[model samples]
Target: MDEWFRSWGLLRDERQRTVFRRTDHTHLAAVCWPSCDADTLYDLARLAAVLMARDHEIDTAPPEQSISMARAFRSEVSARYGLGGGTGADPRWTPVFSELWHSLSTRRSPRFMDRCLATAPTEFLTGCLVYRRRSGNATEADELTAYFSTRRVTVAQRIDHLLAEASLGIELDDEVLGDPLMSRLLDLDVDRTILIQDILSAPRELAAGESENIVAVLSAALGCTTPRALEEATVLYENLTDTYEQALTALLGSPSGRDHDVRAFASALNDFSTGLIEWTSHSVRYTQAETSNWTKPDEIVARGR
Candidate 1:
């Protein structure tokens, strides 16, 4: 696993190396079977690399280059696994992929979604497939194929949504999983995040329309009048916005700032101090949007490209 990742140029430095070591579950029987063979371990490593690539946010090769590289990877893994036949005969096309596939495909599991959102692009897609599979009852293989078949634009949009949630630095409490106020709070935070992105990404000063949008977003999000109304919602949005601004500023002002930016943001957000607004956007358990019927899973599959 380590060797293969190194070949992919994945473990570039001590930090990445440390993360690899930390996440490596080869020794854990629950993650890897007690008698799992080296071949299976290598396959798992490849799958992990595919899933976790987005977390690193490495610039990947273009499609043709990526396809060529993936082909080479498949050949190498197949050779090692002693399934040297080409194309459909390759071992990866077999049920061997299903074993790991089932494990990676999570349902409405918030923890699993959180982990997926925190991962890199490839893994994020894998996470989405898991969601579609578990929630919509689609086959993992079909969804995986459909995902790649879709246009890069759709995939890019999906990644953007996942990245937003991953950067939000919050999670939800099970007790308030179905609370409408909590959902509204999350929706507000999400809108705030979108507005923040729009403001930061713009080249010129905020337009009158954009300015109005900000005020509207803030008005909807920040409960300006009463700190008492939804106390948890109020405080949670405050800390979340604080973290968001600091992280955004740090990224824009100094790209090479300290390594603890995310930690600092999380600390400021203080989710642990109170579990009120700990919900993340990826939590199927929580509704982070004003309207959940924008698109259906099958529709995404049909016109995803």
Candidate 2:
């Protein structure tokens, strides 16, 4: 872990390192990766470390610079094996990806490995960059949610699809990939783990000039007032929560869910969502302002710029 951290001055900023140590993702990881074998956990940690660093790079950088990096990223990653640095990529992080590429060469199917290890992260980091760029300007809730799906595909693919096999680790062929129930479980995990943050932090986020909040995006999209958006976002959050519970129940009842390995995998994924909910509810990160009623997500008020 220390070696990977040193691969590219990752967490080099003392302030960032401090924040990384206590990052909410770490809490989420604690829930998901606890039972993974050493190697699997190691692989996940390395990938996440780089992704998180890259995500934070944009977060901490000036807006123009982040936009520049986002625009330059496609060209930069296209030449991952090139010897020289391109426009936006850090040369040092190249080696990090290079190392992972080599390690993943045998562990996963070549194409799946390529997309998950290479294409998915690029897509996800690109989405994050675009997110920062459009944070305050987004008017389409569907588009915002699409970007949110990138995170789900990236993280869940690592754990469920890649490591857990077709049905969260039951090892069915590619056929199971089309399972709608599985897709629902995956999406529920995503909104549960990611989107809820937007609703809970709407106040602080709006004050900071970021409109990434679900409420803000819905407000703009629905052409409604801020309070109405908040109410709707709360309703949406509740829907997401309810859907998560139902999907998880169905996951546990499916044939794949009958497998011991799949059960554990699904359970870990569920724990991650629940853990994040508990953490977000109490962590100073979102509690900077008084929060809405936990039992009633609809009660949360929205803040505006």
Highest lDDT: which candidate?
2
Cα displacement (Å) at residue 29, model 2: 2.2
Off by over 4 Å in 1: 1-8, 11-171, 204-305
lDDT of 2 by residue, 80-171 (tens): 53323433255656667767656655466656655554564566556655555554354344455564554454333334334444213234
Pairs that collide, model 1: 54-120, 54-121, 55-119, 55-120, 151-305, 171-278, 171-279, 172-278, 172-279
Q: For model 1, what is the error of residue 134's alpha carbon versus the real structure, in angstroms, after optimal superposition?
A: 25
Model 1, range 1-305, lDDT digits (tens) per residue? Answer: 55645555544587656555544433221121212345544444455444445322322344344444444433433332232342332333333333333443422244635333233334434433333333334222223223323322212333333222233333333433234433343333444443333233222222322221223233334444222323433454467667555544544344222334433432322221111122112111123233212233343234312
**Estimated TM-score for each candidate:** 0.24, 0.68
* lDDT for position 65 in model 1: 43
Local lDDT at 43 for model 2: 65
Error of 2 at 221 (Å): 5.6
- Root mean square deviation (Cα) for candidate 2: 7.4
Worst 10 residues of 2 by lDDT: 296-305
Q: Pairs clashing in candidate 2?
A: 164-169
- lDDT by candidate, in order shown: 0.35, 0.57
